[model samples]
Target chain A: MSSSGITPITKSVTPIPASATVVEAARLIEAEQSTLPVVDEAGRVLGVVDSASLLKALVPRYLEQLSHTGFIRQDPAGLLRHALQAAQQPVCDVVQTLPEYLQEGASEAHAAELFLHTGVLAIPVVDADGGLVGVVRRVDLVVALATD
Target chain B: MAELLAVGVFVLAIALIATERLHRTVVALTGGAFVILIGLIEQEPAIAAVDWAVLGLLAGMMILVWGAQQTGIFTWLAVAVGRASGGRPAMLVLGLTGSTALLSAFLDNVTTVLLVVPVTLVLADTLDIDAAPLVVAEVIASNIGGAATLIGDPPNIIIGSAANLGFVDFLVHVGPPAVLGYAAAMTWLYVRHGRQLVPEKERLEALASLDPTAGLGPRRDVVIVLACTGLTILGFFVHGLFHLEPATVAMSGAALFLLVGRPDVETALEGIEWTTLFFFGGLFVMVGALEANGTLERVAEALRDVTGGNRTAEVLGIAWTAAIASGLVDNIPFTAAMVPVVRDLSAEGSDVTWWSLSLGACYGGNLTLIGASANLVAAGALNRANRPLSFVSFMKYGIPATMISMAIGSLWLLLLLAVE
Candidate 1:
């Protein structure tokens, strides 16, 4: 839909295993940019893990229902210490539904729309057979749009 | 032909909803439309079938309560109750759930659970205690408390409006049993979780150190919302004296809040539960077509024949049957379908028939995890937090507590028969 073609970054980003724990996913997310494609041993894309998904598993789930968390202390009784089991949870459990992704040969306009809707820093780009091709970084997509 | 068309569509809608295959609103609207399109009910009559009083009451309360919660009053209330529990594990759980019930008696149960469940999860998480028992307890308590007043639950609103009953009328008839039901459910919860929820010294320290008034603020806004809420409850109490419907009282309460709070009209309108309102409208039209075509009377006649015209069997049959059906389906649409049937069954002017139906539908909703809207919302919240509550786990708690509560309701109905 756009004049500029999307430059999907296939080489730079790394994918994590589907069975990785939240802490392992968190470690990978911190090492790379936010979202890392999640794949099976055969390299089929099962899902993706990003900062948001990791934090979602760590924080109290009901905070989204309230406008304010002012009523309680942050570390009320060593909150993170209590999250040991939560940290050990497989990343797939925290993955909301499945990952929304961009298909290969998609336009910059299509990539931009996916970013806007998903609010993720990077989106996994998949092929017609649903194999992980690459991830389109939001920053790179925006830069291409500016120059095109 | 007309009666068959109406009954067929209603049956299809119920099947689709229970199967959870399509959006319930879509199923209801489709059912409503099919009857009219096939000429089973005329356009004018179908439009007339929607109960404006129930819609008005739901809309008004939705706006008033959602608007009031924006000021953080509910958060402050939750923390204050936690502080009041004084670090005792049982009291802390009971205080939170007890508050959920009491607030549910006055407001919508959905709103009550939405406001309180989050803080409860957090408090539970802070202590590293399992939140399932407490969350499920709150949900069950909400349905029981919702039976106490006219505006407390959706089923009651429909029954009260159709039966021409008032706030105090429901309180007098259903309130005592609801109190007993709540106590029975709470006692069951205590026995199940009280011994298991033993808190260590550190967890006790966390409970003792909470601040109650941390979220109380934006003083002017809080005062306005609370005042509006109080005036709304007062209006419900005195609505009978004014020769006004509960719908009018609720709308007045919403309007008063709007006038004082001065929030944007567009924003305020967005807060209303338009989907639920539309779902109810569709159900009414479908049920209305059934009424117009004489299907509801036939069902009532069948019931009467089955009971051999024994008054006690008739009432208890309706009460127990409602509990079982509501658990299988949902309470809202089930109650809508039964309204016309109950109307045909009741004596020309007595409200006793309405009472049995109300208690059955509301208490019976506690029978399963998916039995009520509140249950699903709580379970969903837990899911988001990485602790998915399985259906079997919830049913383990749901069935026993509901059985006890329903028994209490049955006992009360029997006593009413004895007294008469």
Candidate 2:
């Protein structure tokens, strides 16, 4: 277990560029995983753009009409226009800067601790130079624990 | 020397609070301790100086309000009132301000505005209007509402406890002026923004979709809170009959609610505003030190000389002075410092002055954005929602509303003086 490699999943995970459009970032996030690490030109992790953040950014502002007496009608076209406009912006504008992360060689226990404390679906792993290495998914940690 | 030390500590605490450099509770508690440490007040005297009744009453009511909050009653009421307005923006503004004022009169002003402002914002958004004007009006109204009752505003609570004035006494003396001021304020609000509040048909149709009861918790919990609050208010009215302080009534209600409602005790207690309670406790000791050292008497004499024995002039002077000072600084400490001065100013049958002080300090809070805790809290909520209120923007509404309310308050005081 100590010698187990994380490279299998790391190789398969695609890192998103900081300049990528919101649509591109969203597609990458949905097809690949919940979070796609946004990397700069030098492969340094700039931020992470997740599916939830994309949805939040793209969603049009609507009045929270919580009254049961009647329905507030919203224009579908307005919502679509808002979403399309948002999708044209670079993902960097909407990305959440990484707060903390695990190192590339961090133990499964350490990875689990980061996952638990940060409450993220996955922990971004960076190399000694702080370049994006891979992400340790919660599923990956669970699998590591089960196999051990 | 001891008197100088006490005054120094008191002034420093006020400075710290005004500057917002430290948490106010910290500044107050440290000042209270410094007074004891420097021998201005001894341990026994400091303990004696602390108004346990006011502290207990504040804590007890906080607990009851917390219990009610756990049941989401405030939100339910807000949504219900918003729906009742039928999404007419002007009517919605009126309803929200009225509800905020009424709630602030009984509950904490900060809490009242905190609950109501979000709902107001949502209503504003639904109606395709900016929330700033409605929120500003609510902030002003909350302070006016709070001034009307002994338990409504912290200043009134401190003044009530100091003067041994009953809840009924405050209602009788202060309530009328507060109501008048509220009406004047609402009129100004309407005149300023009534046209802007006209609702679009689409927004009105959208507001009908809101469910007032969406977040209201269990029926039994709501019932328990309502019953406890109702009994507590009733107890406040008749506590004098049982030789009980209002604090005892509040504490008993809280205990009963906890016992019957079966809420998680830890969760229930967590909502208590301990910082505010501590701040009050410390302020009482600081004021007591001033009282002990004859400083209050000297200040009162100075004020008496200034007024030249004219009762009407004296009342108006304190009201206007307090209003301006409260607008510039936090009112709780100003009221605490002035309570002793006002007490010293009162001769036989001089109850009218107390009403003036209450009116001045409470209404003056509407003069600036930072005038009252309620205003600050509402501004904070707005800022968090990305709709920050500027000092200039707030005062545009706040200053005129304050001037108008202060004018009405002064007139009412003179009328009371005339009647007397």
Candidate 3:
């Protein structure tokens, strides 16, 4: 009910659903340095986004023109813009949700393992009902320990 | 004349390895080429003594490790350990050290350390603790742990093959001392770094927040391979039933694992450490050339003379001297070259010299930060991961741990010799 203990600067940043595209994800990430963006729908956490997943989505752009010609009605660059602009898709659709995802009620050590396993900077924290609580960034953890 | 050349090549090999500016495989390969070019070793004899068996075995194991890493199992297991320890520094240290030792005994120390380090760094970062000490503990634990089994450390592998010592032979003989050495190391860590414990509450909160699904991957046939591994270790001691080489058994197990529901070919190939394999292949040729040129024989005679032909005194002398030398030079060559010396010493009535050599070469590696390949690999890996583990800082813990373990090893060697 109260987010007072949470870093005040992180409180106002809203999490988007996993369906969001690279364009939208990048925008959200840039707007605030919220390293973790929990993907949710109707308050149920589906997946999370970090810098890694965002960078991964941008890699296929060069191939889009050749591979998706029949599928696209617009020009290549226009298609790229459209792909980047569409934000309705949930984060889970693009997010790496397997194996490294931190489950609700998991320990910090478990979270650490996920980061190591995936070579990611942050992991999404979920609650008992698979609902989004908040994100735990690597820097956040470091800051916590440094301050504690 | 040829003997001098061999010694020169050997020294160059050590220098190139110590400077770290060149890849080890390259340095060794270049040294191997030097031997061939100088005709220090003829082509026929060079190929004859070149132990492809050792290289094959190392390659097979590297592929196995690569496969395991691909599955993310080790990292996952590390996470589980971290989760269980809940960031209590002492408990975390104990868990990391114990697990690393156990795993290193079964796998190559470098591969094992490489797999575990990332997880350790993540734990350190998440816990907001400096990971240097934990990493240091891992390096020490890995060396000690690898000493427990015949197939664990590179020197042990060579010893096993050279002496025809079995896995059980290593477990019964060297294993106990390795465990004892591990205990001594733990005590040292407690006295030095135990006060740096992080809060328990923070650990619990962190534990409660992990998302497991993010890292899950397909599980391979872990059960069968583990059983085969157990059989392989069992075969080490029970040589009476059969005369199978440990490498043969390892290869057989690996083959069976592949033939019967193993991971894909690409995955299976991941287990081998090719760079290390190349390094070993090249080193064999270099050392072989020295042996051929009669340089190794001269060095052996000199060492024998220095110890006054007192076998027990010689074994202890070599053991202590190696412990000191490894802190300066790469232990792999030091140990490899000593294999023949120890063999000769044993042939001359000091049967315990081989074991002493094994103990010295393995434990002596812990004396300095750069004393062992595993230490260097761990440092490089940590640095690449943006969490650098410095040499001076590593020595802060390494020096004492090395002294304690080496002392125990020296005393143990004396006991083994006295009883004989």
Candidate 4:
């Protein structure tokens, strides 16, 4: 078989349980090349929670108050307040979706497509059972291409 | 007056769906809700015309499909086919596409493709082709095959229920054309990718290494799922031919399958695409609004004015229009909305024109990338597996395959209508 210049890379994935604290999330993100890990607790992937998800999670009584006003604060202090509040929130509070999650795959092409479509710099590749396998990043592809 | 507003809303919904700007089911359900609201105010037949039987049929079929998938029966079949073909790249394509087409006629094409694509990718890696052509062939074949049965494609389901058409009706009217189209698809693949076939020994090795277990189930699971599918297909035909409602037959089949297998009810329910059902409901309401607003009547009148009530001219016009419209829009809504229009035209003179519209709408999806829900679902499944099927990539086969099918459909209709 002919090999292409694009070699599938595997490394630096960050995963946490949905119950992990914001400090834990921030540490994992900082440790793992600054990319968010897909979180799960008790073997179920709750969506990936990055800084954005963490911020969303911080807002108390999100579902209780359906008014749009809570979502529309623009002051820097208000944004900081939201972020700080989000930091206190549980990972489940800011989950991206339901039982069936949209995730990346182990294939190089799969990684590239996810990156292109979702605009994520890196994506968490999962096994068929939804366990974290590894991470594929833009830099990985770029490096592989450059060496080739 | 209010009807016009509903129609404008419906058109906007169609545009959003066709452009892939939102989930189709969402768009459809929104349209259905709007129509229901309008119906409450206008107090028209919109509510009466909603056809809960069709909705029930769709819901039951979806659950049946989910049961089959849960068992990994389809995945096992794809693996068996790949092994039987010895993984020769060309034979693999023929086997996978042929089998996919056959299954798609009874089961959902998306489920069929989802099962087949991963196996094909493994086979492709073994034979060492780009895998794109094989993927493309399977999708096109799935679409064509699904066109032959009343319950095969989504648009067919809508058309069948709306027209009170049955399984035998589809087989008599659309089956022959579908066969011809499948043959053409094989030929197309042969010309495009035949040279890429590898050695028999290498092919055998590739076949041996193939493991379809990525989503496989227990042996008991497989047996029960296959039995359920077999019964459902049988029920679809029996119910259709014997004057039983298709919805009744489908729901009965689903209840039996679930009861006998004793699968997880919660998982099966979750697996059902509720959003899609909502979308269908929405589309019904939107179409209802159009019907109430006189938009369909106005269009029918315009067509009558053009054709001078000549049935042949009208049939030809409706067929080609359906084909063209399907290329640019989601054929389910387009065909569903057109059902009454075609019916009125047929009533104005002869009933042959409705069949033409049915054929056009059903088969016309082969004309473009976004033509049918089956096409989109297949494309989405493959793309999820790391192989994105682009519009240009799909049209490479879709355009030609559609032309051939439409031509054959026209000729077959001419013969059928003329002889009888």
Best by the DockQ measure: 1
Fold similarity of candidate 4's chain A to the true chain A, as a TM-score: 0.63
Q: Is candidate 1 or candidate 4 better by TM-score?
A: 1
lDDT (Cα atoms) of all candidates against the true structure: 0.83, 0.83, 0.70, 0.70
lDDT of 3 by residue, A1-148 (tens): 1223333212233677555655667777778654645555577655556666765454332222121112122222322433454344545656756464455445555655666676656666656676666666767655654565
State interface RMSD in Å for all models: 2.2, 6.5, 16.5, 22.1
How badly does each model clash, as a count of residue pairs?
0, 10, 45, 6
Give the DockQ (2 decimals) of all models.
0.47, 0.21, 0.02, 0.02
CA displacement after TM-score superposition, residue A31 of candidate 3 (Å): 8.4
> In candidate 4, which residue pairs clash?
A14-A37, A58-A85, A58-A86, B28-B282, B29-B279, B32-B282
Cα lDDT of model 1 by residue, B312-408, tens digit: 8888899989988888887888899899889888876566778889999998878887788888888988876657988888888888888998899
Writing each residue's lDDT as its tens digit, candidate 4 over A14-133 gives: 467777667677667766555565566645455565665554454332222221122122222222444475575556555554233224434455555656666555556556777766
TM-score list, all predictions = 0.91, 0.90, 0.72, 0.72
Q: iRMS value of model 1?
A: 2.2
* Regions of candidate 1 where Cα sits further than 4 Å from its true position: A1-4, A7-11, A17-21, A42-48, A74-82, A89-107, A124-136, A141-148, B385-388, B415-420
- Sort every candidate by lDDT, greatest first: 1, 2, 3, 4
Docking class of 2: incorrect
